[model samples]
Target chain A: MEFLNASVIPYFNYWIYVVLMMIGLHAMITKNNLIKKLIGMSIFQTAIILFYVSIGVKTGSTIPILEHHHDEGHAETAHAVAESGDHHAEETDHEKSDHGNNEHAIEADHGIDPDHFANPLPHVLMLTAIVVGVSTLGVALAISQSIYKDFGSLEENEILAKIKQGGPGVDV
Target chain B: MIVPFDIIILIFLVITALISLRVRDLLGATMILGVYSFLICLLWAEMGAVDVAFTEAAVGAGVSTVFMIATIYHTRRHSSD
Candidate 1:
């Protein structure tokens, strides 16, 4: 019960994806029509996308864009470090150039906080997936159209029957 | 853990999916599938995946539905099974 409350309850969105995936799977398996199967495939694909997107969500967080205020904070810290380094440079004038380079690196590091931004890796990957899915759907629809043109039906068994008879339409 | 709005949207998604599968009319199934995609789009946006939601709305709801409808127009809309 403790594990359920801690782990399972917090990830309710994943449960929604699981249910959706099962429904899509059932449709893909049981449906006879090609178009229906395509619909099922789309649903399945979207469910998987949802699952991935949900994994990236953080509570009370905004989008991945770094705000101007964070940038200002980084600049202020960098400026303070440079001021302190200038005092040290009076004691050791040889390292002044190196300290300037280090200041730039520190500023870059402080410019963004990982926890403040949503995970962008998943978003980039899913964008490719969405394009691929659209292309696959297009090709599948084209094939189904050709099958209908040749076999005169989109039902799998009917197409098989037509193929078994070695109909003239099968040649095309 | 449970957001009432998300739960409501998920329920609608499940209902649309079931209806799409069970409906005998191919066109009706396609339309229901469009509805399913739109709902998922909203859900993803709510989950802070605006990029994914945008893509899904365009591909799943917009182009895919149009392609399926065009294919249905070319092919037989009724399944003989």
Candidate 2:
């Protein structure tokens, strides 16, 4: 009960992914059809992708994209910085104002809080993985079709049985 | 982000995976696997991975299903498992 409340309830996302991965593994191992194995492989890859994406989730955070200051624009910010430098040239108390500017810069650095946005690194990585999984699935299915043409069946046991008979590859 | 919604989708995801793997017809299994991909893609979008979700929707569900179906067209339809 303690473990359930502490671990299972809070991290149910991970537990579900674990179960999904096991289902894929069982299908890959016990299923006799080549297409079924390929399906299992797809499921397995998806589970891992889901796991990574979930890890990057931050509660109460927005999407990773930062809001653009489109209205003000880059040129406006640059203009402001240039105006501040002009004040340094003519100001009688430049030293005092420079000390205040340093404090403002420190505050600006502190404004970059990570909790406001979701983690994007895992998502980018998983995008590549999703592409790779589809390509691998396509290649494996092509191979399965080729094997079916050569052996006349897609069942692994049947193919093995035919191979044991001194083979279709040998005579046919 | 909503707790109940996540739970519902996850339950559906597991159900889809099992159905896809256990179905005898390779074509039906392929379709169910597409559903599996669609659900996971939804999960990603909800989790704020919009780009990943878009790619998964296009590649995993759309293109891969077409590739599988095209192969099945030339090969045997029923898988003897």
Top candidate (DockQ): 2
lDDT of 1 at A97: 42
Q: What is the TM-score of chain B in candidate 2?
A: 0.95
Flag clash pairs in model 1: none
Question: Candidate 2, which segments miss by more than 4 Å at Cα?
Answer: A1-3, A70-112, A168-172
- Per-model clash counts, in order, read 0, 0
Give the CAPRI rating of model 1. medium
Per-candidate TM equals: 0.77, 0.81
Q: Considering every candidate listed, which one attains the maximal lDDT?
A: 2
- Scored against the native two-chain complex, candidate 2 gets a DockQ of 0.72
True contacts kept of each: 0.64, 0.73
Candidate 2, residues A1-172, lDDT tens digits: the string is 9998899766777988999999999889988988889999999989999998887777776566645533345323223333334535443444535222322231233353345545666778898999999999989989998998889888899988888887645663
Docking class of 2: medium
State candidate 1's DockQ.
0.54
DockQ of each model against the real complex?
0.54, 0.72
Model 1: per-residue lDDT, tens digit, A17-82? 898888888778877888888878887887788777776666654454444644346423224344
